[model samples]
Target chain A: MTEAVLAADDHALLKTQLSSALRRQKLSAFLLVAPLLIFVTATFIYPIAGMLERSTYSPEFALEMPRTAAALAPWDGTDVPGDEVFEALALDFKDSKTRQATGRLANLVNVELPGARGLIMKIGRGVDRLQPPYREALVALDNDWSKPEIWQALYGLSKAYTSRFYIAALDLKINRQGEITTQPEDKRIFLPLFLRTFWIGALVTLCCLLFGFPVAYWLSVLPMRYANLLMILVLLPFWTSLLVRTTAWIVLLQNQGVINSLLVWTGAISDSNRLSLIFNSVGTIIAMTHILLPFMILPLYSVMKTVPFSYMRAARSLGANQYTAFIRVYLPQTKPGVAAGCLLVFILSLGYYITPALVGGESGTLISNMIAYQVQKSLNWGLAAALSSLLLVGVLLLYWAYNRLAKVDGFKLG
Target chain B: MSLPVYARPWERLWYYSLRAFCIIVLLFLVMPVLVIIPLSFNAEPYFTFTEGMLKLDPAAFSLRWYRDVLENGMVNQDLPVASWAWLSDVWQNSQWVHSAKNSFSIAIGATLLSTLLGTLAALGLSQEAMPARRFIIALLISPIIVPVIVTSASMFFLFAKLGLTNNYLGIVVAHTVFGAPFVVITVTAAMAGFDRSLIRAGQMLGAGPLVIFLKIIMPLILPGVISGALFAFGTSFDEVVAVIFLADYEQRTIPRQMWAGIREQISPAILAVASILVCFSILLLMVMEVLRRRAERIRGVTPA
Candidate 1:
């Protein structure tokens, strides 16, 4: 009985020791990854989070119009703000004018309510010249001061954190009655731009697949030496400068370019009737398809290499025709490659900026170009953040789907 | 595949048509890039073929465009080409040269940083004891999947707030984030094929972990690490969006310079630069191919 008890004690001790060892191993493993995780978190993840936060966090109005925001906080949304709110606005405008921030304040308010910028600027310029009873003075300064919608816009935007920017991003706004509605037809843009971006991306992916499939098959079937030699043709462009390739397309596709010149020489078309191909959607599509075609071919080639010729031969012997044999035995085997290649091309084309910016004229410009315009030209950072967040969510969803369908860890660069 | 000597004319037609289609696709892939090389050597500052070029005249091709690349941004272009002043001017004040310097520095910095961190993380990930492996891998690779414009905008805001905008460190860090995914992918692949028994054998011979890794594992995975570094370098070299947001004029890179050139002007000088870059890419491609073959031979998949 004593011997049995000792053996049980020994077993328990061994279990504890093994468990401790495992814990140590896990700790060491985690320690190895900690540096990169922390670096990526700080440099990448944190920045993105801060950018997303900007969509809802605008402090310009609240900081410059603190008294007005405070005074209007208690006023319900049902009607125009009273005298105290106007007095607070007058005080804020006086301060902002002296600080030279009134213009910025006006721009901030204008983002939420069009035509309010001029009123704010006028009030800012005349705030000091006005006497007491500042409410009537402000109303006299602009008839817009009497409108409830303008006040509502100011009140909605006065908060340090508001969804005004997100609503604007969707091309919708909350009106005087606090109802969410679409912008007028002329002003609605983001939704269509998003759709156009996706459409262009899909078209580019399709073009790449059409061009890449036969080449990949040819490479896979060729002997090793010739296959390796032909692989360089794909990889050369893959490693070439993107701007260079785009420039090459411009050189080749311009009206006075090599292609048009060749066509004219061949009597296929008159020189006066040369096609206008560059600086449009056609140019964007052609250049992007060329650039991304290698991405499709590489994945497909790698996958196709693993498929044996015997399977097709077996299918053919079983009385299937060439097309039927290929469809039944060959196509299904290349599905993962197709999924990976298409997803990669589609996602990349969706985010393309340089090529589109260079070649995409007014009709071809994508949502990314608009986001860039908002950041650089419009200085509408809030809207840019909202658009970017939407894009991020879409990309993440696709990435998750890709992870499920094709393990990203299995991806090979070659 | 060779055409089967089938007893049908249709099969023969289909086989020939397929071959024709593949040849056309291959030509489509290679023609656009190859066409630029000859055009860059044109004597005239034109994108299209000049009459002299079409006639194959001796005066058609000149090194004038190549000279323009050297002279375009020199502070003292009037100085004689062989003079020390001219060399220094080109080194210090030539826009393309300055951008090339910036590109190399940033690419090297980013490559070293990403390769170090990513290789370490990959080593940890290859171990069975690693926790939350898939989630961590996903996070590490997210930078490559996220739209670069989004990443640039976010980095702009963060860097602006931190006063890191217009700073080299900011660009380097952004590039490291971008390049780390390639390193992780490459190193992880190398480690996946690793023979764990070799590591155990070294340990059983009474070697310390550091000695075993340096002597046994490092050499085995060096090709993967080098390829990853090349990828990281290429990514940093080619990147421009982040530079647009985070870099000041002083921090301009090759792609940024090219972007401005393409947007503002189309010159043969740009083509000259493009030709040089194409040559550089070819060199890199050859190096990578040779390394890949060497790696295969080392792994005993091919005869040495």
Candidate 2:
């Protein structure tokens, strides 16, 4: 039978035609795609790479005060060895104000030792002294100031650019006084916060999936005209502003809002009831679930639409009950939608800032909230970049993991 | 085994219950946005019951807030008295726009740059020529995945040295970067349904690559191009962080201004602006749908 089928296939002509068409297609595609390649390279790739370089490359210590950095480059930590190093430091300091260079210098030294700030400040204070032992005086103001550790800090800061910020973000500290250490156990808050962010995101995504799946299934099975109208309702939130949606939630969930009023009127709760729903983690979960439910529903409905009714009927006819048929057969078929919806919700929730910031009290804030505070309020770009890098890595890892699972499971989400 | 009448009764009950449940879900989803349209005209800006309020207070129907926003020109009048108060005089000291002209200029410039980059990306991506296309596409659009805060934080120092910070160009560049990925995604989807034969035919007809792009490819993907442009415009218009970090005194966009307004004062003016934006987005969504349908017709794909 196979041989008979193969004999009728006309394979040679098909191969020849397919090969020629594909090559022609490839060349045409490359030509058409060139401009976009160049544009992405310049705008997307170049600028971000430039940003990474700017953050990691220490130019203050290495680029601006090269000669001074060179002079201190060879000094071992044992002694206050070279006058030339001190002279170079003084010259760099004299040419610049305490404001411009000193703060950056402090940041570099800060990587190694927490007390480096005071040491650097003392050095700045002694810069104007006209004494015989001025170098010794500056170094003696803090004994560690002359230690190779201080020089390293100065040299590090002087180079003006490095990945020290990135290092600090991971909660690792460097020091001449001590080896790089995990931030003191008490101060190590970010890791916990990062985990909390993931937990919250996962919970919200789960809530959305649970609430959306049944509704999407029902919607998909509806008559076409009714489904279209219902789908519009599902999508109406997309037309509303995000700010408005969040603000509405805030109002609705508040103590004096319609929800509480209704509860009181129906005698579901006391008239004196004062609920604390809007400012806590529960509020964050509820609001996010509401906002993201449609993301889950859309994917589910799209997938469920293509699911043939025969599959379930076949399972049922095979002596399986309706519940068993759905659990074993229909659920597996909905995997693609489940994956897509979960991915969308998880990814979006990971980066969510505005809603959590507005509604989330201390317990509800996510990694995005911390990142915002670092940039806008604290003005700590290095730490912000560090935290952001962590979040980025996390998101990429989750995406990669999901894609790998999909590949292994033979699940293709459109 | 059961009679049809007995079995049919249970089915009817199930169907009715399902329909009722679906209707309730629909009502929950649509009510919020529909509520706002009428509430925008409400004398009270608060999201409370308005029928009784509107009936008792005819003065509330007066477009006083809208008039105040337009005539007082408050959006252009003072720097929002918060973190942005320091930036109130930025234009006098720099080339930033203190007027609506500046906002228009920045949005337009960012939109153009982003659209060009994004459309090209979409076309390239649609062709599927590059090695490891999925991986490359993912990386290329990774900006959207990297939260905006991270991008802004990283760009702050980079732009500062490029002398792009605190200037119009700086804000525009930041906006362009943020907007490009959305453009890429939308345009790429549009190009996915596009036929490759037309471009091949153009090439065979002796048109140069650029000519084929302008005369053949562009017209075919024009809807995608337009969609990308609209997305880019919205992205820039709505961006807050990168502009907040990169722009100094002169380059405040509407969102940046709004952020300050929210923190510093309780102005109803923001609601007016937001109402306008809601209208704009709806109008824009309509246009995108029309273009999408037109593109489908050109490609000879049956409309759903």
Candidate 3:
């Protein structure tokens, strides 16, 4: 009995020792990963989250007009606030003028209610001259103050956090009755831009697939020596500078460029009848297709390399024609690569800025270019953040779908 | 690839047509890039072949564009003296030279930081005991997959808040994040075919973990690490969007200069820069190819 108890004790000790070893190994693994994980979090993920937070975190009015903001806080947002709110706003505007912050406040309010910037700024310059029937004086200052929508917008802006930017991002606005509705037809821009971005992205992806599949097939079927040499043809451009490639496309596709010159010299068209290719949708589509073609071809080639040629031969022997053998027997095996390539191309094209900004004229400008314009030119950071957050979510969803469906981890670059 | 003896004429025609179609596609891929080389040498400031160029006249070609690359942004271009003073003036005063310096410094910084962190993480990730490997890998690689505009916008807002806008450190950090994924991918690929038993053998010979790593594992994976570093360098070199959002005049890079040049005017000087960059890319591509082959040989992947 003592020996049996001792044996059990030994077994227990062994189990504990083994678990401790396992724990040690796991700890070491985590320790190895900790530096990169922390670095990525600090540099990449945190900044993105902070930026997305801006979509809901507009406190400009609250910061600039503290008294008015405090006064409107407890007031229900059903209708316009009472005279006290107007008195607070008038006082705040006077202070804001002295501080030279009225422009900022006007800009903030203008985002929610268009034409409010001019009215607010006009009233701000003359606000100190008004006598103390504050409501009547403020309303008289700008008849726009009579609209309950302005008050509702002010109340919404008074909050530390609001979804106003997101609403605007969707090209919608809140009515005087606090109902969500589409922006007036003249102001609606984002939805159409989004549609155009996706449409261009889809076309580019389609073009890449059409061009890449045959090249990938040829590469995969060739002898290794010849195939390796040919692979460089694909990869050289893949590794080339993006600006170089875009510039090359410009040199090739412009009005006085190579393609037009060649066509004219060959009597395909007159010099006066040269094609308008660059600075339009055609240029964007063409350049993007060229740029993204290698992405499609590399993945397709890798997948095709794994598919044995005998499958098509067997189909042929079973009385299938060449096209049937290709479509039925060969193409299905390459679905993963096709899915991966298309998703990669589509996602990349959606966010393309440089090519579009360079080649895509006003008619072809994408949503990304619009976001860039807002960030840099318009200084509408809140709206930019809202738009970016939507794009981020869309990209992540597609990435998740790609991970689930195409297993992009298996993808390799040559 | 081999036509069967029983093949019909239509089948033969289809096969030959497919081959022809592929050749056209390949030409499409290569022609644009090749056209730029000759255009960069054009005496005339034109994008197309001049009559003299088409006729192969010597007068049609000139090194004028290449000279413009050096002289365009120089402070004292007409300084007739071709001495060290002239060289120093170009180095210190030329805009392109300054941008090139900025690009190199940033690319080097980003590549070093990314390679170190990514290599360590790849080592961890390849281990069986690592927790949440898939989730971790996805997180690391998300920077690469995320749209650059979104990333740039986010970084812009955050950097503006942090006083990091127009800051070199901010751009460096941003580039490091962008570069880390390539390091992870290449290092992990190298580790995939690694023989753990070699490590064990070293340990059995009384070598410490560090010693084993240095003696056995490092040599096996150095090729991958080098290739990854090159990729990281290329990424930083080619990047412009982040520079647009984060950089000021002081941090203007090669791509940023190119962007401004393209936007303002398409000069032959820009073509010269493009040609130089193409040559650089070719060098990098060759190096990567050589390293890849060496790695395959080391891993015994050849079908000998």
Candidate 4:
């Protein structure tokens, strides 16, 4: 102590320096990751936020027809607007026609008022002849122009931010009373499509498990040389192009294709009755199951590889048969693997786009295909965004569950 | 595992049946990929095996489809071999060739980007002093977890607004988001068993951080980074969803062209492309296997 005793203030200052060093290390580590975080925000996260905004904040009509919107804004919406509002609408329609913005305005209105697209386009087409005394003249062009309901629908479209697209996504409608209600029986497509999607996902997951279990067990129990060779089979499929596999399935499942050809040649089935396989649920299930089978096997094999062989032998010595040892003794230990594989396959099948789009025709199409239809064919980006957002929620929830079970640091891709 | 001589007839039956079941399952996994290779050589423009093909007649196989890939868009395909004009025409206008060029360029660009960003983040996350490690890792990996359609559609909207759509750069950036997760996962996995004492040793030996990284750490993690790069390449190469949503006709990639071929008509030309892609994937698979084995040998001193 007499040689080099530090003062009390100096000791406190050293402690402060040590803690500051630790904090500096933490800060440096965080800074290393910051570039990627910032990059992802700009490229990915911001876009997703923008699309969600599109679902509710579409201003196609309100932005294009301001005068009409303002005139309609004061009405109670219980009845059609008077001539003053109609004059504003007629003039706005004329301006929108000249600006080439009527198509968008009509498309927005058509989302709320079904079968109104042709009427609005027709009105826009003939807007040059649309004279004043506008209410009677507009109503004379089409009875629907005078109906309080159509006007009320158009009034809803007048707003910049609305929830109508989301309502339509749920297969619901907004009536003249401005209340949420179910779509008529024939119009309810999405809810049923979503249920079918989940149903198909479960089916595919079950199929993967059925095929994957024995194969995974075989790979796990075998010696390393043999196990590694067999694993290549699984990995090859995992690495193959999705379109290639889908094309292969098409070649195998088409009526003039391999399986049917072989079946007919072997006299197992008549040429007149070649199986209807490629363009239906059967093709989708079979193709998806084959494509996803390796996903199930890889995880199961990884888990089973760690299980000691002695446990099954002990179960056998304790008066259990091979089947009982496997069912009771072995499988219980592989629960996490089972859960992981099922959840992974199910999650994948739910959001599957290529296989289903290629092989799943009509009744076989899932919710993903419907979203594609909205984007490409129907040109309903608002409804498409809404549906995708819902799908995102479901997938995210399942993903969170999978993380809890697998506890994988990050997902391993083949 | 081989069957033990328990001397039970039922157990013998069970063992044989299980083996048979597993063989069929393995066949299911491997056959679809192999099935196309032979079909691609069909002399007839048919997907199914003709009688001659089944009999392995020499005349039943042709390279017409492969020839088609090169000749489909060439202005003067009949020009003599080794002609520069014909070659340039093929390079510029051949549907499959042009798409292939675009595919490789996009894949390479995306792979480089994702590998750089993902490896850095993975390294930072591995640091003992890293804060909120789990949450940051989850956020980075969410790109993989999210559905491709949602990602594609979302990016389409934003990129449209920013004037980033219909260009190779936009596609590259979108694909990097998809590709980054693979790089991050593989690199993080490789670093999980990394020894920290080596870093201290390097420092004590009077080495700088950059020197130690390049001379020591890079060697150990190169295989991981390489495998991750391959994964990223494959992810971008195999992707068609983003292409469908984001790219115009001018920026078509292989998968985009393939999608059109499938939808417009089922063509043997597609089979040719599929055959090429399958072989490419096999090469990729072999490289990955090599990297995995290298990693194993490197980690011999560590816990499995």
Where is model 3 more than 4 Å wrong at Cα?
A1-4, A73-81, A147-149, A184-186
Q: Estimate each model's TM-score.
A: 0.97, 0.78, 0.96, 0.96
Q: Residues A46-115, candidate 2, lDDT per residue (tens digit)?
A: 6556555645665645654666777766765444647877777676655444446766665555654557
- For A70-171, candidate 3 gives per-residue lDDT tens digits of 999888777668999899999998889899898888888887677788988888788879889899998888877877778887888899898888888899
Candidate 4: tens digits of C-alpha lDDT, residues B1-304: 6788774888888888989999999999999889999999999999999999989999999998888878897777678754887788888878888899999999999999999999998889889899988888888988887888888989988988889899999999999999988888888888887998999999999999899999888898888899999989999999999999999998899999998999889889899999999999999999998888888889883322
What local lDDT does model 3 show for residue B195? 92
How far residue B24's Cα lies from its native spot in candidate 4, in Å, is 0.6
Clashing pairs in 1: none
Question: Sort by lDDT, best first: what order?
Answer: 1, 4, 3, 2
User: How much is B59 displaced in model 4, in angstroms?
Assistant: 1.2
Off by over 4 Å in 1: A1-7, A74-79, A114-116
Index of the highest-TM-score prediction: 1
Q: What shift in Å separates residue B49 of candidate 3 from its native position after superposition?
A: 1.6
In model 3 chain A, the worst 10-residue window by lDDT is: A405-414
List model 3 lDDT by residue over B1-304, tens digit each.
Answer: 6677898999889878988988898888877877798889999999888999989999999999887777666777778545887788878888889999999999999999999999999999889899888888889988988999999888888788889989889999999999999999888888888899988888889999999888898999899899889989999999999999999989999999999999998898888899899899989999998997898788777732
lDDT at residue A74 of model 2 (Cα atoms): 74
Residue-level lDDT of model 1, residues B28-138, one tens digit each, is: 888998899999999988887888998999899999988877777886668988689888888887888889999999999999999999999999988999999999999
